[model samples]
Structures are given as structure tokens and as C-alpha cells.
Target: MTKTERQKMQAGEWYCCLDSELSALRHQARVAVHQHNTAPPDPAEILSPPLAALFAGHGENCLIEAPFHCAYGLNISLGSSVYLNAGCTILDTAPVTIGDGTMLGPNVQIYCAQHHKDRALRAQGLEIAYPVTLGSDVWIGGGAIILPGVTIGDGAIVGAGAVVTRSVAAGQTVAGNPARPRNGWSGQ
Candidate 1:
């Protein structure tokens, strides 16, 4: 039996993004996202009913500000006390997990899909996806971009405007373009 495009994507194998199932899922996510973004602002509510139901897992007190976008909401999991600021975009072709107390600043982007290097494959919309995990108590500053397959460990701090291409160890502080470790700065 052949694997579905979604299955291949989740397995980190090249798959066509033009598959009908994937397209439908993306459409569903778009509707939910739009509802959440345009709904009447309720200070007490962050994730609207439709948007919350779209996610695979959502823990208590998770707050996602408006203008949040994801390719497929079902691929995202959020733990308790997680806060995502406005204008965050997640291309969640694969699983994206955010542990408890993780806070992401405004305009943060997380990408799970990597397009094929070959021009023909790229033109064909073939890509592979890898899971991205942010452990408990992680803090990602504004405008940070987390690439596919990156795991940020517990208590880690990612600096503003950083492009993280690699995993960050627990309790580590990373800064700069490629997100290298910084000696000090606990990010408190």
C-alpha cells in the first residue's frame, strides 16, 4: 500500500503539496484562522471555539494572539500557559509541539517544510517536513524564525530576529543570525 501525501510529509519524505487531502486540510485551517483573527476581541478569550477545536492538542490558559497562521492547525500542539504573540506563522506540515510556559514574541515564524533542492522537484511542489519542538519554559523573542527539525530545550532563550537553523540545548541562550550560543544573558 502506498503512503498518503500527508503520511509521507510526516515521515520526512518528499511529498506533493498539491495533494487534494492536503489542500482540503489547508483550506480548513484557513477558515479557522480567519475566524479567530476576525472575531470580536474578547479580552478573556484568546483561542476561539472553532480555532481551538482545529488544533490536535491545546492545554489550559494557552493564549494565541490574532493574525496567527498555520498551514494545518491539526499539526500543532500547545501545552499549558503557552503564549504566542501577534503575527506568528507556522508552516506545520509536520508536528509542532510547544511545551508548557513557552512564550513566543510577535511575528515569530516556525517552518516544518523544506522544499527539494532540485529545480524540477521544487517546481513540482515536492517537499519534506520535520517536526519542531520547543520544550517547557522556552522564550523565543520577536521575529525569530525556527527552521524545520529544530528542538529548543527547556529553559532556553532565543534572541530577537534570530534565524535558528539548529537545536538549542537546555538552559542555553542563543543570539545572532544563525542563533549561536551566548555566554551570559539568562533572558530573565
Candidate 2:
């Protein structure tokens, strides 16, 4: 089979190489970030290089640290002055885009793919993908779980530990399992 074609065989060789390539890249980036951050400097420049390697496209002044995970290399893009804290994991099976000046708190999980709910199909490891987007100046609080195809609008604030299942409007503050708008516009 070709690179994208996966047979029902026990071992998928194509998948292994792709995964390995991504893993190596991530590892290298992680190491570089760790090394670069050993000494602190002015806050104006970007703080992490590992984060840059993980994205498909990235602008200036981004600071991404902690642990991160993704599927394909070309499925992610990020804008300038973004800060992603520790333990941020991104499942980029599809596309994931983050706009400028967004702050992602610790332990934030953003997933752009979902597996089948059916146990048999899920066990078979067959699944589809969906893309996710976040607008400019949004703040995702600690431990938020953003699901597939969710578009967080500009200046939105996602509360800590909320499980977001849908799109959020501009300047909205949302919280809860299936996040809904909190009091009012508090996007700052």
C-alpha cells in the first residue's frame, strides 16, 4: 500500500515512519527549548524553539513550553505573541490554528480528531478528523479540553477545566463541561 493507505495488517510500516519523524522533531525541539531557556533574557523575544518546530506555520513572539503532542507536521499554525503553558497537548489529526496573542494555560488539551463511538470501530482504530480554530487574544484557562471543530472567537476566555464542545463567540467568557457563556464579556 501507499503512504496514506493503511491495511488491516498487524504492523503499519508507513505510520511508524511518520510517527518516528514527528517524534524526533518534537524531541529535538523540546531539547532546544530546554537549552535555550536555561537562562532568562528580555521578555520581548520568543521563548521557545521547540514550539516553533511543532507548528506548520508560526509568526513572531510565541512562547510554547511544557509537553506537546500532535499528529501530522503540517496541520498546525500559530500567530505572534502566543503563550502556551506547560502540559499543553494538541491532537492535530486535522488542522489547528491559533491567532495572535492567545494565552493557553497549563494542561490544556486541544483535539482536532475524534474516534468512532462504536466500540468495534473504535477498537479497529478507524477514525475521522475535524479542524479547530482559535481567534486572536483569546485566553484558554488551565486544563481546558477543546474538542474537534471548535472555533473560539476573538477575545474569548475559556475557564479552567472546562470541556468545550462547540464554538464560542467573540468577547465571551465560558465555563463548564459543555462550556456556556459565563457572566458576560470578560475577554482580556
The candidate scoring highest on lDDT is 1
Tens-place lDDT per residue, model 2, 1-188, is: 45442221112121222345445654654565455446455466474554465567998878766454554445678898888887788776667899999999999999865666787766765566678899999999999999987999999999998999999999889998899898864533
Candidate 2 lDDT for residue 169: 97
TM-score (C-alpha) between model 1 and the true structure:
0.97
Tens-digit per-residue lDDT, 82-118, candidate 1: 9999999999999999999999999999999999999
* CA lDDT scores, all candidates in order: 0.93, 0.73
Q: Over 4 Å off in model 1, which ranges?
A: 186-188
Give, for candidate 1, the lowest lDDT window spanning 10 residues.
179-188
Model 2, runs deviating above 4 Å:
1-47, 185-188
Worst lDDT 10-window in candidate 2: 5-14
